[model samples]
Every structure is written in C-alpha cells, then in structure tokens.
Target: MSSATNSQLAIRTRSWMFTPATRPDRFANAAKSQVDVLIVDLEDAVQPDEKAAARGNVRTLLDAADNTALPPLAIRINSLLTRFGLDDLIMLLDAKHAPQFVLLPKIESPEQVLQIDTLLTAAGKTTWLVPMIESARGLSVVEPIAQSCSRVAALMFGAADYASDVKAQPEALALQLARCGVAAACAQAGVLAIDAPCFALHDAERLHADLTFAAANGFEAKAAIHPSHIESINTTFTPSAERVTWAKRVVEAAEKGAGTVDGRMVDEAIAREARRVLAAA
Candidate 1:
C-alpha cells in the first residue's frame, strides 16, 4: 500500500514506535508519524545519568499538548523492582496528563502488575498496563501476567532480554518458545499480543520474515525500534482485503448453518477466527 493508504488507517494496536525518552528533538515528529502508538521509551533508550532528564522531558511534553492531537501514548518504564522503575512510576503518577499505556519491563509475575495498578488507581490515573515478558521467569507465568489486572492491555515480548536470560542467541528459532508462550497467554487473556521490535533496522527481508513469524504464531501487533519499521508492522498485522472477504464468507456460512465455506469447514474455532479477522479489519 502507498503511504497515503497507511496513513488513512485508523489508530489501532498494529504498530508501536519507540522514541528515545532523551530525544526531545524527535519526540513531536514521531508523534506526528504514521505509527499507531508512540512510546516514549524510558528504559532501554536512555542512559542511567540521563533518566532523570528524560522523565522531565516526558512530563513537559505531556503538559504542553492536547492528548487528542497525538496517537495513543505509552511509556516503557523500568522494572518496578528497581529504583529507576520506582522513580519512573512516581513521575508518571505526578504528570498532568496520563499516558494511555504504561509498559512495565522485566515483569515476571502478576503481583508486580497489581502493585502498579494500585498505585495508578491511588493517583487517579486510568492508564492501562502493558507487561513486557522477556525472561524465563516471566514467560513461565505469562498467562497470569496477561490476566493480572483489568488494566492489563497487552503483553509485549522482549526477545533481547529473554536471549540474555536464557544464554541463547536473539533469533527467531532461539526465542520461538518464548514468543509462542507469550502469544498464547495473550490470547487466553483476550488481550493484544505484541511481538518484539525488530533490531535489524534496515533489513526489510528480515523484518518481513519476523513479522510473518509473529502473525502466524498469533501475535496481533509488533513493536518498532525505528520509524522505518512501522510500515511493515502495520501492513503485516492488518488483515488483507482478500482475507477480510474470506472472513465475511466464513461468517455467512456459520450464520446460515452451513458446514463449510468454499469447501473449508466452519467449526466453532474457525468461526471465532473469522470474527476476529473482521474485528481486526
């Protein structure tokens, strides 16, 4: 599709673009981009010495803008177990405008999500949680993590951290189990499953394969470390026109008590998938 077609697509969870929290020069530009969600990354993108200033930048940006003008905003805070995470939490709570999503990194259990939810509640912010599952421990309990709280919006897989934790390479084959686990858990919770951001910044072929892997395994969205990745992410996650037509046929078949659509069986699971495709479209 052309750039105009991509821009015409409404705001959905198909692509999330990450901007370094420290890059004030690029913040507004990223917000105006075609990315579905603009995340001011406070974790991996900022240095320890600059984390404080990054937090301030986020606050000032939020203070200066009308929320409606921007796409959905998210902040990937450090783990709540760390001092940096606690400080990030405090900054978000005290901000004049709350982000739509708060991405918690290195989340291994449901309790961490609950604690953050409680704090946001006390502070009167309605921000939803996006748990980043990037560890063996986190993947083990991903089901509970995805279903942790009502505010839990999505589960984002962090392959880099998982690779480090498992002493493996950060490739699709190596992280396939972790990815599948996250996707299944998100499905169980009836929330969006976000695949990890493609680190190969300019390798279009690698990015396409990565996105295909995520989609085939049930992930609904993928994160982008750079703006260039947003187009592929959006295109891959979106249901193609042909698939949408097939889904409509499947739905009609199920409603008419037909056993098949174009010779394919329309069982409960297939019918459910068709409905989901329509929803995505």
Candidate 2:
C-alpha cells in the first residue's frame, strides 16, 4: 500500500492470477481475491476482435475501483510490435486511473523494453514494467532485458507459449533449464523472476509439487490461472521457521565481525546470504 520506490519495497508474489480484461464482471471479484498480483490480461486472454473493448473495460474498471487496498494492478499489454499494444499504452497514459505495472508479452530484446520505457517516461508516467520471456530469443537475451530498463520490476516466464515455440513439453528438464535461465538473469539484476502457471489447475497435489520445484530452483513467485491455487503457492514460497531461525543465527554470529559457528567461519558472504534469507522470509 506504500508508494515507496520499487527498489526499497518487496513485492510479495505467491500467486499472480490473470483476469480477462474484457470481462468487467470478473474485475470486482479479482480485486477482492487473495491473489498476490491481479493481472488484467488484455493480450492473449482477450479475443482479437474484443481487444479494443477489453482495453476500454479495463480502463473503466480501474477508474471505478478503490485499488488502494487491492493487490498490485498490472495490465498485460500485447506485444509492442502490434497496433493494439500502442493503443493500449495511449489509453493508459490518457486515463485518470492507471495501473502500477504494465505486463509486456513476448519480449525478445532490451530494445523492446526500452521502447516501452521511453514512451512511459515521455508521458510522465512512472508505471513499472515487467516483461514476459516467452521465446528462445527472449530467453537468450534475458540478461540484457533485465538490466536495460529501470522501469522493469520482474521477468515472468510464459512457459506454455515458450514450450509451443520451442516444440517441447512443459514438464521436461530442458524446459526447466530455460526457466532457470530467466531466474538467474533476474537474480543477477536484483529483480524477481516468476514461474509460469501450471496447466493442471484441478490437481492440487501437482500444483504443490510444481510450486515446490519452482521455489527450490530460485523462482520467487509462481503464476496461477485459478484463485484456488493462491493459498498453496503462498505457503510454498514463504520461508519455513527452521530456515528463518538458521538465517537469523548466521546473521547474529557474523555481526560479531569474526566468529565461528558450528565449526565453520561466518564471514561477510555468509552474513549477506543470511540477510537475503531473512529478507525472503
């Protein structure tokens, strides 16, 4: 709820759910939902013919709502290469009420992000941007994209689209490597990397398994197609008490300048890792 700059804040992302921007009825429900990030999807979720209407609906909904309490509002705009994306940005800048983040899809290079950032800055808008790395080109250029724009807050994995583009299955190890690549890129840039939504919505066990795998592999957050998955996702990403305790102890010992903990020396690097663990908690 604070308006602090992006760098100073920790945007907790357990479950980021995408709602169809064309469906105004779903907006109110989503605003009250438990999802960490309510992504008003104006791109893939909306039919091509309804893109215009969806954009209008989203603008109206944002205007009408008291979004101060709702989870972060993000508008998933179409690729900047299309007319729809340009229109989307125009409408957003002109509106009285604007979303906090613009979720960009199919980002292939840093130039794509720079284009969006340039437009947003020229319009005198500070809306943050998060890119979706959904293709092989995007994956390969992830590092540059992360460091290119100051407006970028995170990188989201569009696994379904990426898998189709690469002609592979989602659960494959090769896909995991691609996901890790994005995570590492985000980490290097000191930003969060989000995992794509698992398609098996009905299987809670499968969702938990996937969330656990993602958490272990350095993904700070995971997307959800359904609200039902939010609780599990949140629980999975949060640090355990045991982990927190260990981190605290390490930090405490390292603060003494030079000390040994359990037969190992606690140095500056160990202290830094401990602080990171506490921060994640």
User: Which candidate number has the best lDDT?
Assistant: 1
lDDT of 2 by residue, 1-281 (tens): 22222235557666789889887677668655678788999999999999999988877866765766668788998887999988988888887777877899999999989887887778888787889999998998999998887788888999999999899987887789998999999888877788999889899788878887888888888888888888888888778899899888888898767887667789888887677778778
TM-score, cand. 1 vs. native: 0.93
Clashing pairs in 2: none
| Model 2 bad stretches (over 4 Å) | 1-7, 260-264
TM-scores of all models?
0.93, 0.92
Task: Report the C-alpha displacement of residue 85, candidate 2, in angstroms.
Answer: 1.1
- Single out the weakest 10-residue window by summed lDDT for candidate 1: 1-10
For every candidate in turn, the CA RMSD to the true structure comes to 4.9, 2.6
lDDT measured at residue 3 in model 1 versus the true structure, 0 to 100:
15
